[model samples]
Target: MPLIVLCGLPGSGKSRRAEELREALSAESGGERRVFLVAEVAAGEGGGGGRAALRAEAERLLSRRDVVIVDAGNELKSFRYELYCLSKHTGTPHCLLLCPGGAPRPDRPPLEAPDSRNRWDWPLFTAPEDPSEPLPLPEIRAALFERRPPPPNQSTRSQPLQAAGFLHQLDRLTQDMVAALMAAQRNGVGPGQVIPLAVEGLGQEPPGLLLSRAVSLAELSRLRRQFLSYAKMHPGEGEENLPQLGSMFVQYLNSNLL
Candidate 1:
């Protein structure tokens, strides 16, 4: 299924465009494909912010057999890129549909228009301000069908784990992922920052462990305790099980933390 991120500001009519795109996509796919229009950021299973929730929802939906339309202002270039990386990592074709001429909001970051030169923003479309105007359906379909988006090639910022990937290796026989992640927090990495399992360049920086949102210190502390307790019971011997343990713990955290 394809992923479409609707970009604009508070009053840019992203929701309406999202519905319009959803309907069009369903119709074009003859109702065979389920189209999801996300009007609001979903409440997270664990903890994080609204953006993290949206990312979580998108990741969940993208994993299944459905098309996703994210109806958010997506005001920051960084956020948009995050979605792009997720889609790529998931082997999902994605595009950016921008709604121009949106009313600006002082409370939000200024919108960063999608750049044609950037590969992630390719297959990008702009929704006309007029509600009656038609969306770029054919082009979008072509983009989705033309070819599968290449598998994630590099660890991008929004893709977090390139820098914060110590999670899978978190409980490496010699390394303490929790302590390192906490150290990252101590170094001023806050909510929504890439969560490094270790400090910069210290451990294996794989491409997938990301907290993606804000969790309270109490919550993290509790979660750490839970992981540590579990580790004590079944500490596997040798280095062969490092990945398995790290992966299991990461899954546990993602399941519980968000």
Candidate 2:
């Protein structure tokens, strides 16, 4: 069984997808292989860089199960590499599911780079003057407000727009993922691979837009109609836009077997 790692930003629906993967894998196993899910937060690990406990739990789960799913915002290159190392040490096949997380909203401030925040085991995006120090707010503000900072190598450079920046983050994340997975595969991890799965509208609505308290039935109907109209306009993009977790797992297994 392959150790599947769910990587995405916050509110990216990784948890739900992880649960889906766990259930799907369990069903496919038919009581023969145990499926375990280890969440980074629930592991009670203290803070960023405190993944030892989480890693230990994953190792233990792997020992008892045929599949282990790691649910976390593995946005940093280093963290993904660490998982690769863990798979190598434990002798388990590893595959990464990279969720593009949802679309960005224009109203909110751009999300700080995952590395900019020290909340998780992510590598920091630091200034060139001091690699350990985060880029100053002035630099970040210049990038975000001025709409451009500098070139790629410039530590202060940011994406042209928030959406562009998020996409860029995904690009960098996927690149690192491929590098790590390739290394793992070379070292004998079974089909160490990366899959891009997008779950649309994970956290698009704000509290005011939620259905329970404020939203009326008429408003909901309008939203539904709007969605239907949009879908009709792009009929070819049907449900095929993103494969379900179960279908993806099945495809992975089948490909490996072949």
Candidate 3:
């Protein structure tokens, strides 16, 4: 079972989809295999320490499960790539499930979390993956401790923290990282599968609506249409009818990551 890295912005239904995928995979496995969902939000500490803890826990969980679904925003390319490297180090097949949400709205502001030094986010795990073989833990440790080279230029050495400035920076970073992933995909060195899913009406109702009173009826109505369309596309068992979505997931898994 591969480590399925859930990628998307906040409120893109990653956790919900993770549950659906877990159920689908387990059912296919005859209900005997265990699938664990490790949410980055639950990682709590913020910054590298938080990420390190999350990865450590994921590694531990992987040891005892048939599949491990890492549910996180993973908004940065470097972070996603770092995960790819970790999966390689552990000799586990890894893939990405890209979940893009609706257009960003000013009313729906992102959390103002502490900024992570992109260059140092994963100081201990910076190497790229070798799909053919996993590296030895001793060598990985040595690489982590060894001095790293300076950045090729100064721009990447620092970034502005203003809200607008940061969002633009994030946009550029995501674009670059996605392009790299696509290149790697073509080269047979990227994720096993880059599943693209656009989830509509994310902020309109139910969980989101309850949390945010700012959501207007118009927004809610629009969201309902989106959900209905999605549901129509995917009919499944139970109230959520997520099996349809699960079917799409399984179909993607069948494709070669290369």
Q: Name the best candidate (by TM-score).
A: 1
Candidate 3 at 56: error in angstroms?
Answer: 1.4
Off by over 4 Å in 3: 102-258
Please provide TM-scores, in order, for all candidate models, with all chains considered together.
0.58, 0.39, 0.39
lDDT of 2 by residue, 1-258 (tens): 446666666666767767766776678569998888899777763343235566667767764247777886655443444454455445445556555445444422233333322212222222233223332434323322333211222122442454344434333433333343334445544433332222231123211111112223443344333223222221222232222212222222221222
- Clashing residue pairs found in predicted model 3: 192-257
Worst 10 residues of 1 by lDDT: 230-239
Stretches of model 2 off by over 4 angstroms after superposition: 102-258
What's the C-alpha lDDT at position 249 in model 2? 24
Model 3, 91: alpha-carbon shift in Å? 1.7
Candidate 3 to truth, TM: 0.39
What lDDT score goes with residue 15 in model 3?
Answer: 73
Q: How many backbone clashes does candidate 1 have?
A: 1
lDDT winner between candidates 1 and 3: 1
Candidate 3 displacement at residue 236 in angstroms: 46
Where is model 1 more than 4 Å wrong at Cα?
41-48, 152-258
